[model samples]
Target: MRRRLERHLPRALERLAHCIDQVRMWQPGQFNYLNSSQYCLYLYFLSNTIWREERGDEAVGAATRLFLLNKALNGIDLFYEIEMPEVFFIGHSVGIVLAKATYGNYLVLYQNCTVGKNHGVAPVLGDGVILYPNSAIIGRCRIGDNTTVSQGTGVINRDTPGDCMVFAGTAGALVLKPATHSLVADFFRV
Candidate 1:
């Protein structure tokens, strides 16, 4: 696991660097201190997680401590910063909160979805996960691959297994079925 994570670290760092460059270009001088502050916070989060997985024991205490410090210093009302795999945002607006511990790939989070910490628990999302507008997933939970969390759905303390369809209702239910590719492709046809 450590080896796999180590291999991906360079790519993650590159992405972070790219984001910083973009921010620098746009703001010029406004975000100098703010950018460094956020960068340090993100680095602290990433390093501790990596260290815990690799060395163990030594890295366990740093993440929580740093997170608390970040919140106190920044005066931001929201807590939780999402660390995502290599992916670009198609569109993003303000007021987005993503938890540090959540793990996922190819995630697309539209504006206003709060992926937050629920009693120090973080969500584990699978690949190709899309959280539509106003969707909130909190606590220790797993949302499966290829799943679309519809708008205004709040999920807590649950697991949506792989290849399943989740819908809201009085008695909310999930159906496990293979995703059909051609059906999805039809939606893109001009």
Candidate 2:
């Protein structure tokens, strides 16, 4: 496990730098321990891919998940085999899907968000995707980069373009629109 982490350290470092950049930290190293969320997310992916086939390592992975994330159990508890890039954030870690055969990068997930298979199909998410609280992306959908899935919205069997936002309409339907604000810049404010 240490060897695997060592091998992936540079990638993690780079990703951590990106996270620090996102937060606009003056010192990158200090931002690493600013909170435990970043480390937990890193361990979440690591526990799934690197230690998936190992028993002892998986045990450590289970402990990590249990200690950090609330929803995951039994060794990472990933819904599917996912490949995610770095500098992503997962809020509350409840019901957020780790891709049921999908890929993601720079993804941000809030509480109760799900991104997995609706039937037998999975969605492919691009970079800088944000799944707000209580949102979902399921089944054969394509989510482009810098897209925001707003609160209380769910996407199924649809394709969303880049630099857009998905919000719940008056009648509880999903509506798409051009991104008016900088997603990366105004994310925390929203």
Best by lDDT: 2
lDDT per residue (tens digit) for residues 1-190 in model 2: 4665566556545555665455432344554443545555555554444434344755556535433452343222343134555456655554555555555656777777777787678789887788898888889898988899998898878889889999877665679999987575544322
lDDT of each: 0.52, 0.63
Check candidate 1 and list the clashing pairs.
Answer: 82-98
Give me candidate 2's TM-score against the actual structure.
0.69
Model 1 has an lDDT value of 0.52
| TM-scores of the models, in the order given | 0.51, 0.69
lDDT by residue (tens digit), candidate 1, 149-187: 667777777788756544555555433345554221221
